[model samples]
Target: MNLHLHGDAIPEGLSRRARSFVASHGVRADATPLEPYRERWLALGVPGEVIDRAVAYQERWGGLVLPPAPVYECGPRYLYADVPEPSHGGGWWFVGGEPRASVAFSFMIGPNGEFGLWGDTWAPLHASVEGWVESLALTHHASQWAKQVTRLHGDEVEGLSLDDFEPVEEVQGIVDTWWRGSDSLVALHNGEAECFSGRVRRVALVYSGLDKWGLHGQ
Candidate 1:
């Protein structure tokens, strides 16, 4: 997927010159080193050998230059436009509007395009929301706060159906655990409609990065 960074100017405090160049060139936000190779191989149903080639290319060539600081706009739009932190391998995030429904992030593509993805959702780590939260090690007090939010939103709402609601609950459980007694923040929308902005914040909390886990082929 191609990533698109939209704003009048790239932020001033970007860390890497490379990322600045990327933004200048209009690189898609979700585009990553392995994308081209992955697309090619997936179309052909080839073996994993090509992924290795892609990784090598990234190691030798791929780098990001990021704008400094988180950029915010009116209408509840947020752009994670800081220079890609080496701590997070410079993965960028572009979250648009309230009630968010479209989002993507970078992924690791093995040689020949074997890839690992990190985003709002994933399949393999399919734990219920409660289970997921418990896994993240919340403070004892925070768990209490989280419980209130969870209880309010969990299975209580009417006509609530989400493909990842269960998993999100797991995430919420974790966030609640960590956030309790910290004056962290909580906002809930009444009625059956999910308070999607809150959900988006929950997802962003754990987004250390998309392409950091040796996707470039360690």
Candidate 2:
């Protein structure tokens, strides 16, 4: 299957606000020049080569910067290159920008077939995508996990940390193996979405807090 992927390599700690904003407002593909992302990239003093490469990558695949929206929380945003998917529980929204991987092209998949995430720098975000996807899958695999989480905490939402959980490699392996059979996956977020047409699925949102996620789409 053919796929196209588009995302931002945003700096840490600055993604939540962006994500919240979009979730509150909505996702727009035709939104002109993405100033927030561009400015952030420029501030990071990212190498021209990397910028050129990323821009070229987007151009080749029709990737676009996420449109500004009301703040949902704070952090990087991952707007799909296509429209949001309606199958999965609500839709998938991004709290952090796509994760980066050292490898140019690494394929990661989630069991639900919701969407894929990737990154440019692997070492740091190496398992980021796998972590996010696997974490989400954990709830699906063992509904007990979610039930326990909810029942244990009740509506109080106390002590829920994304960092506290670990990704199950075995489950990720199954998802990855399954993804190989398909050509591409459709990604959705904040009432908007995009399609990734490539072999690389490496983007991820660093889950610093549980509130970073919401049931808006669900």
* Separate clash counts for every candidate: 24, 46
The sequence of per-residue lDDT tens digits that candidate 2 reaches over residues 32-144 is: 22323555665665444444434433332222233321111221243222211122433222212332323232222222332333333111122233333333332232331
Best by TM-score: 2
**Against the hidden true structure, what lDDT does model 1 obtain?**
0.27
User: With candidate 2 superimposed using the best TM-score fit, by how many Å does residue 63's alpha carbon deviate from the native?
Assistant: 7.5
TM-score of 1: 0.18
Task: List TM-scores for all candidates, in order.
Answer: 0.18, 0.24
lDDT of 1 by residue, 78-161 (tens): 111111111133322111112112334322221212122234331112122122112222212233233232323333432333
Supply candidate 1's per-residue lDDT for 205.
22
Residue 3 lDDT in model 1?
49
